[model samples]
Target: MGEDRRKEIKYHLSEEKIDELLREAKDDRRKERLGFLKNLYYGDSIAEAADREGRSAATGGRWADAWNEGGLEGLMPSFGGGRPPKLDEDEQEQLVEMLREGQPWKSQEIRHLLKQEFDVEYHPDYLGKFLRELGLSYAKPRPKRPWRPENPEEILEERVDDALDEDDQPHNKRKGDDEEGWIVDDDICTDGGTVLGFFDASQPQPYDNSRRVWYVDDPHVERPLVKTEDSAVGFYAVNGTSVVQWKETEEKEQICEVLEAVREQNPGKRILLVLDKHGSHICEYTRKRAHQLGIDLVFLPSGSPHLNPIEQVWKYLKWTMAPIIVENEDEFHELVKDVFDQVTQRVSFAKSWCEKFLDFQKFP
Candidate 1:
């Protein structure tokens, strides 16, 4: 059994009964045991109950056994024998299943559910810890495209395979047994091999914006909004190297230029650029240029920015420069280039995409 796991438990008092006694009971010791019993009755582990009540697990066991053999009278200081738990094994399992269905639960909402569903009530503060002990926590929902295909994962795999465009079996690792493995692109792409890269464009303006900042009564920080935008088209290879090309405007011409730069950077290697289906990217001129340069373009599904890994890189770059003020477009471009170069020189960016879509081998 797991460390958190306990043998079968049985409880004597209903939650209403416990709460009523808790309100009227005069003895602090009786109240403490009642609180412990309340938590234990609502499916908290012995360790959780003991920690919440500031008692030892062994003592909780004794009290629980006392309650099992006795009820409300079992929590009395005189009780000698062991008692039982509030929930039977089957009821506990059913509550777990029910709780999981209506997620992102508020403390009061969950209390209502417990009371209505099982006639139980747990302290609000103790509920969070209790849920964690049972393997649940609050989490933000990821954005999903409502119109996405039913087989998005399958389509994703097919897209990656098409991008590889090699005598490829759908194998993640192409390098032979004797060859050295790389965490980042390193010198492998330069030596002639398929290069997987994420492509994107960004037009960062010279304005300060941040998600959070420490403040006293009120946040009163003023930001400068300079009238200049820095356009950049870029490629970030899974091998740890990135190529950022500064552009005057975001157009098909600049898109082609970035594609050419990627090919020039990874000469002789097949370049598979995963990018979005923007008009500038999907235009005839850009496609012609990419095909001529031996590059394959794989467009991410529309409305799904999270599917492309490079989006994170752009967010990171912006967040890195959020506080600083730049004098001009030149200064902003230089800052963007420096930060992008420093952060993208690692294979960490591609891990999420690799895990979700590919049968990737372990990195050496």
Candidate 2:
């Protein structure tokens, strides 16, 4: 490698000023230069600061010279006006193809690819724009399970609608899969219930579990959470009454207890409890108890957690509790229950579930 062209240059700005400039910096290159300066200000050599900033010692010397002559303005990148993307149409298409082959590509990875393959360098900000112009977008992808039923809405509608079956009795539903499938048993409750609700169990862990999350530009710190052995279960009643309880473990017996809780919520009516077919859920013991409790169990298609409305309730509970700190497991459990009660109270949680699956005029 060529020797880094560096010089021992005197500092012109204070560390605080460098920090201020970093905060105000909109462009990433400016931040990089500021970072190089930050290291240098903190008693690092020119070479050391440059290496820390992932730039060569030569570039560090140039930045120091610019800072010396121009101060804050000297550190700013002077990109020439009206520069065009280096890749031609065919070349751009080729780059897109390469991008398609990779699973996930960070901007830095793409930048390296561009420099290596096409002999062009684009800044991260400009790289995003260029890729967008090439019709690529950066976004979080929702998961899709291959085993998820294609006709989820239809399956749900059929389950709840009285007209769906010739006998008009609620049957134990089943889902087929590559493995031994979850199947609908013909001999189910003669009349499950008129009251409809959803049931699911979830584990709400501590904030320290996440590696990254969005935060304000200030102190992004999190306290070490008092880990809890508690997981929570909830019954989201579509008409607004819901029940939440913390569980030591989600067992088949717990399913029976939740069914009792839901039954108590609406004593006179039969209960329709829609949920996934977890190991604790679909066993002979749970089904027999649900039947005895006058609760009709509607199993969602395998791998289709989205079909259960209580899943959303769990998601909300987790989000609401993510920032909270609890000193003990009991405190954490209370925090979870408190938050769960507040969130699931609003019948709005199951509004989408109702809209998609129920034709209320007939379903009740």
Candidate 3:
């Protein structure tokens, strides 16, 4: 509103600096580049000056023209919309009360409530203005736990002890959210099955799907997907890949056999079998065999798939496999197996990809 205020905010750049920014404006970071120019001349708060210079206030060219014409005052906002203050203090208070209890209520929602309750119709855009006037603009909820123990020593010790007790009691053998012995990953499942990946001392890359998987048969075919109306009922296996019927119910013994196959490939190494806290993965038989084979089974904490490096790689694999278009379980198996084969053949590619990914977001 004041010329001095406008002048104070305007950017005062050297000729060379202005030219550099103008040149940089042509690049992809054009908005930022031109913003710097406008900020220099009008301190960035020159919507009116911008509007006067050009028909549309959104363009940078108009702001430049405003700089070329009248100085900083040209950019300041002017009274353009209309006269203000129709809803007195009482209406504002009512709006706040509605906002607190309303379910997903927008400006239009309030307008409807006004029509239904008090018989008033307001344009959606006007409702936005009303809300803003009431000081109810966008805001993030204050984080509840802004600061937590960086290393909760008790939790860490428990995790470490759990890791060490793989042979004794099996890591996290507790029954999960399976009332009927049914552990289901939240929907969006292509094939009704689950896959497992492992990490060991020899293999620095924690999860490479090509290495080995504890593929199992899943009976829940209702599609474990999160729906807007339905509470997401399955695990969002982050680093892990799609479930598959790579092995059958009759093949539990063979599942251990395949894991042993992986061990045979990587000999004399302390094994770390990383997987979700699933009912099937944690059993007395599986624990006994892992102990016998000198394998250390580890459980990822509940509601944490991001901790698994393999889940991330599996995402990449899924994205790559998306175009293949498999219709059935057999076709899905073939395609997934084909993907596994490709990843298996290119050991360096898998290793490099996992290593680079791990460094990007490291894991324990």
Candidate 4:
């Protein structure tokens, strides 16, 4: 380190002016600059003043030069010498409008569009940041189709009532007589014998999953390509509080096996298995097996995967596995197993997913 040799020179300011500058400084950097000037005006050496302000002697020397050249105005921060923005005002406006139109776009697609339309190049990673600067944010694309029930609210209410009826208990007892009847309480229901399980299947591919990421535009940077040669279908069952079971398979026989295992696990409890109306789930053989195991296979309304809470688990699994680049089928299976283990360990996390995403409440 070199010492500042301008100790003989002095910078002067009126006491009232110093106080005014200190009071007017709105940020820490401005306050630091004012303090540096105050120390110099009170006969402190540049090195001592710089040390007091937690700055190096060379930095103090530059500030002293700025003070001599343009007074306090020179001490104001100046940001310069960076590459200019790739998108101009009009292009940014166009981009914002495009995003507001709600067309799902990947970062690479946006980057290619920018290059093709405006002759500007941005790295895939930096493009997200640039979009954020324009008040746009990246998000996972949700599947939306025009097919829906005419009375969705009624359907939802029916489903809730059906679930409650499956577990309803009588609050009032009847007298000991052959003709006596017990009163069933509509408001009171128990979850003890009823297990609410959501089921879904996902085929995780090797392609990088598109997700929300902070993007900026820089052409020189290169993002690593995620590649894989193997893929597998996952069958998962969650009861909101925890993952009851999961398996890797596409065969419908596996679904029967899962139901059987759940039956064995809960003994006499009735399994209310909520799942989408996939053909396999509604097939004769699958229904027979579920019936034998005392599992009520309740299907969601058509085109309504969002109604099932296990869909969130599938999304979480995909998000967890997105960054991993599996070399082969074995590695992919192992990674999936590891991620499943991590998720199943946190019971509260599973419960929250059920409550928040599926509106499935847990009973004590």
Identify the candidate with maximal TM-score.
Answer: 1
lDDT for residue 260 in candidate 4, whole number 0-100 = 63
Best by lDDT, which number?
2
Off by over 4 Å in 2: 1-126, 140-146, 149-154, 160-170, 173-193, 205-225, 322-328
User: What 10-residue stretch in candidate 2 is worst by lDDT?
Assistant: 176-185
| lDDT measured at residue 37 in model 1 versus the true structure, 0 to 100 | 80
Model with the higher TM-score, candidate 2 or 4: 2
Single out the weakest 10-residue window by summed lDDT for candidate 4: 170-179
| Ranked candidates (TM-score, high to low) | 1, 2, 4, 3
What number of backbone clashes does candidate 3 have, counting pairs of residues 3 or more apart or in separate chains?
23
Error of 1 at 362 (Å): 16
Worst 10 residues of 3 by lDDT: 227-236
- Per-residue CA lDDT of model 2 for 154-251, tens digit only, reads 88677667432324332443243122223333443324337677888877876643444566796476676467676688887876367878888888
Point out the higher-scoring one by lDDT: 1 or 3: 1
lDDT of 1 by residue, 1-364 (tens): 1333374567565889889989997877678888988888788887678669876554556556666776667558343445544453346556666777766677788789878988877788887775654455567766567877666666777777655545433222333422332122333242365678899888766565565767788765565556555477889898535799788788898778877678777776766778887898876566656665766677777666677888888888878777666666677788888888887886787887888775454121
- For residue 291, model 2's alpha carbon misses the true position, in angstroms, by 2.3
lDDT of 2: 0.71
Q: Rate the local accuracy (lDDT) of all candidates.
A: 0.69, 0.71, 0.43, 0.59
Q: Give RMSD to native, each candidate.
A: 11.9, 16.7, 15.8, 16.0
Candidate 2 clashing pairs, residues 3+ apart or interchain: 174-182, 174-183, 174-184, 175-182, 193-270, 193-271
Residue 234 C-alpha lDDT in model 1: 82
